[model samples]
Target: MSSVLYQSVVKNYGALNVLRSLDLAVPDHMFLALLGPSGCGKTTALRILAGLDMPSAGKLFIGERDVTRLQPRDRDIAMVFQSYALYPQMTVGENIGYPLWIRGMPDAERRAKIDEVAAVLEIGHLLDRRPRQLSGGQRQRVALARAIVRDPAAFLMDEPLSNLDARLRLTMRGEIKRLCQRLGATTLYVTHDQVEALTMADFVAVMHGGELQQMAPPADIYDRPANRFVATFVGNPPMNILPVTLAEQGIAIGGTPVAIPAARLAACRAAQVVEIGLRPEDMSVSVPGAPNALPGEIYVVEPMGNETLVNVRLGGGNVSVRAGRDFRGAVGANIAVTFDVSNACFFNSAGLTAVHRVNSDGE
Candidate 1:
């Protein structure tokens, strides 16, 4: 296994800059996901690393070797595409063994390697079938087997689960995570799915507008986003953002004073905080006129089985609150929402995180 590095990598197409001096590092045997929406340069970065596309400037490295100008074949990396790029006419065994065969491995050894990889992916029984004969999951397994048979320095996966059905996607997510762990391989995965990035990767690099937004572990990415873009992008319901005015006591959201810790308040004051962010799970339905509560009307209620998502229309904005499954409230009903000020995130006028609440108890 080998580490991967991108040193000030930039990709420009005419007047459009695709990647803006991106610098990233994937530690040896680490699984890093390049996560972003469409047109966010994630796929471009992966392609540049795989030698399928060249960067306009800067260097790329696999381990200690600079592979900036190397051909794809010489880069010593295996890619699993989103489409499961398997040979239509060739049997599963032939597809998996193709890499070894091209490298001049003996027929017997190539067959053995194919069998070994196929068994590991649990597709050994389908080796004789062509691509059209197998189900989507089985075909994906075959593609994985083909990549694994090469035993390259790093594995590059580009949305390998996007084509599968929802249930199959869930199963394959676990399978891919387990497979990577077992091999202890260096992996760089590119995807737009936040769930996939958060669940499978050791580190997630969130990108937007051809620039790196944040790179952190899953929990940190969700709990302590770097800026407004990251804070609003990574969450499911997304964090609730409200405009706030600085006050002598603390801050005021929609003209309602909210108490905050002295130190945190000072930091926010120093940074000239203009907004506060609270996650859906951080706020709860509270009694009307309660301390540190914002009076609002119920905008909507969604029964999510395990929990009810309540959207309340406050003076500042609509905020989603995670309530108990048994929560029952009428639309337009008067209500109050309260949250821990210590758990709030303060943002500056420039949209950067001014101060973030650290989960000290590790909740």
Candidate 2:
């Protein structure tokens, strides 16, 4: 396995900018997920790395080799496309061995490698079946097997599980994670799904508007987002941003004083914070007269299987709170929600994170 690097990469289409000054590095054997919404240039970045597309500017490297201008066949990388592009006329064994065949490996050796990879992916029994005869999940396994059979320097996967049903996606997620880990492959996986990115990758590089937002371990990305965009984009229901004012006591949310740690308050004051972010899981429903609570009316209540999500309309904006599954509340009902101010995030006028609380125990 080898490391992958993109230095000052840029992609442009006429007047439109698809990627801007992107500098990313995936260390040897690390799984890095390029995560963003549609048209965020994630796939474009992947294609550039795969040699299927060239960057408008900057350098691309696989290990120490410059591969920016190399042909796709010369990149020493295997790609698992979203479509699982298997030939319908070929059997699974043939599909998996195609890369080896093109490379002029002996037929017996190619077949042996195909069988070994097929067994690894639990698709050994289906090697004789054609693509049309296999299930979607099976076809996906074949795609993965083909990628694995090459033993390439790195792997590039473009939303390889997007076409699978929910259960199949879940199953494939685990399978892919384990497979990559077991192989110790340097992988760059592109997907718009936050769940897949967070669960499968060692590091996640978030992109927005053709620029890199933040790249970090999943836990750090979720708990200590670098800016308001990242704080709002990563979570399940997303973080809630509410206008706030510096109060004499500490900070004010909707005219109600909220107490925060002295250091955090001082940091907010230093940065001239304008807004506060609260994760749904960090806030809770409370009595109307609860101290340090923002009074609001319940706007909606959604009962998720394991927890209830309550959206409350505060004076400044609506904020969702994750509550106990059995908790019940009616829309328009008077309510107050409270959160640990230390756990909240403060953002400056420029939408950059001003202050974020870290656990005293050094998590």
Candidate 3:
């Protein structure tokens, strides 16, 4: 149970820079996910924390102790890689007890610790099975049991479930989250999968181009993205970003009128053109006469069993709207769409920073 912190961590390989002054902290017993695409420096940052890669500059700490110059073994951290890394010749019990054995624990004590971790991981029944005799999930459990057997100060995991099937990944997600909660160990997870980060971590640090983009809880990152890149990345269907003109009469969407409040209009006075963000589920299709509605033509309709996703063409771009399962709108049909003022996100024309939202009554 230790907190992890990195300050001004910079990593460079020759002339190419991988991380730019990266600073992050995770509280004791908290799970933080370092989430981004490949080449985003997330894996590099994880390796630096694990003491597997040395930072070109900056400081690293585990619980109040500055460990920038510490070796991997001296950092008191356990790491789990994507490949499982289990020895084919070793049985499950042997694999789980190897860490204790290498640390010079007595045979009886090593076996007791192995039995304890195996029972906690629910792999006690498979103690005698080799890696070849176990399923992928079972093998992964064995790998995790080995890591936790020593009770290290923290755990560093690099896409540990990336090789599993979708169903298995979902199951493992729950298992991993439960295991961390039960152990109360500070954990750092690196992955490109947004679902894994959102479903498992206490907080998510979104990164891009070796820079920290946004660090927030999953719901805030989804509802109020700091920038356009985050807005488009975190959601499944993604948020629809459309260009609109801010005016006293409200915003103009494809030559049609959509009324925004005077307060919001005042808040966005710096730009004549602003980018408005709307989530697929936030917009609804209606008849053409609703007040504050923007007229559009449906280009496609996809029935998703539980609901329907309607792609409507507004001018040259298309906007996706999530509708009820019973929605029967067809392509080529004219429809009006409206969204709640409070639910929409505003951004400057460049879509760099999130614009502030002010409601009606000039408040």
Candidate 2 structure quality by residue, lDDT tens digits, 139-175: 9999999999988999999999999999999999999
Worst-scoring 10-residue span by lDDT in model 1: 354-363
Give the number of the best model, judged by lDDT: 1
Off by over 4 Å in 2: 360-363
Model 2 TM-score is 0.98
The digit string of per-residue lDDT tens for model 1 on 58-134 reads 99999999999999999999999999999898999999998899899999999999988998999989999999999
Clashes of 1: 0
The TM-score-based order of candidates, best leading, equals: 1, 2, 3
Mark the 10 consecutive residues where model 2 has the least summed lDDT: 354-363
What C-alpha lDDT, on a 0 to 100 scale, does residue 58 get in candidate 3? 99
Pairs clashing within candidate 3: none
Total clashing pairs in model 2: 0
Per-prediction TM-score to the true structure, in the order listed: 0.98, 0.98, 0.94
Candidate lDDT (C-alpha), each:
0.94, 0.92, 0.87
lDDT of 3 at 65: 88
